[model samples]
Target: MIYKVIQINFFMKGIDRGLNNSVVVLLIIQI
Candidate 1:
């Protein structure tokens, strides 16, 4: 159970990073 939770957290972090990267790209394009 603990391992599953850790895996989910890691997956979430990856998704967050992807979102942040896209946002940064959009901002750069706007500028």
Candidate 2:
């Protein structure tokens, strides 16, 4: 169970980084 929680947290952080990257790309395109 502890390992599962750690995996989930890692996955979520990966998603957050992806979202942030996409947002930056969009801002660059808009500008």
Candidate 3:
């Protein structure tokens, strides 16, 4: 559970950097 939160945070960082929004959405969906 902790790892999942961390992973989400990591992806959030990517979003903040203006990374691919769709890819992030897909990843979050998978999670």
TM-score of each: 0.55, 0.56, 0.56
For model 3 the local lDDT of residue 4 reads 92
lDDT of 2 by residue, 1-31 (tens): 8876776676567677776777556544644
lDDT-better candidate, 1 vs 3? 3
Q: Please provide, for model 3 over 1-31, each residue's C-alpha lDDT reduced to its tens digit, 9 standing for 90 to 100.
A: 9999998898888888988879888887978
Question: What lDDT score belongs to each candidate, Candidate 1 first?
Answer: 0.64, 0.64, 0.86
Q: What are the root-mean-square deviations of the candidates from the true structure over C-alphas?
A: 10.9, 10.8, 1.5
Best by lDDT: 3
Per-residue alpha-carbon lDDT of model 1 for 1-31, expressed as tens digits? 8876776676567677776777556544644
Can you tell me which runs of candidate 3 are displaced by over 4 Å? none
Model 3 TM-score is 0.56
Location of the lowest summed lDDT over 10 successive residues in candidate 1: 22-31
TM-score for candidate 2: 0.56
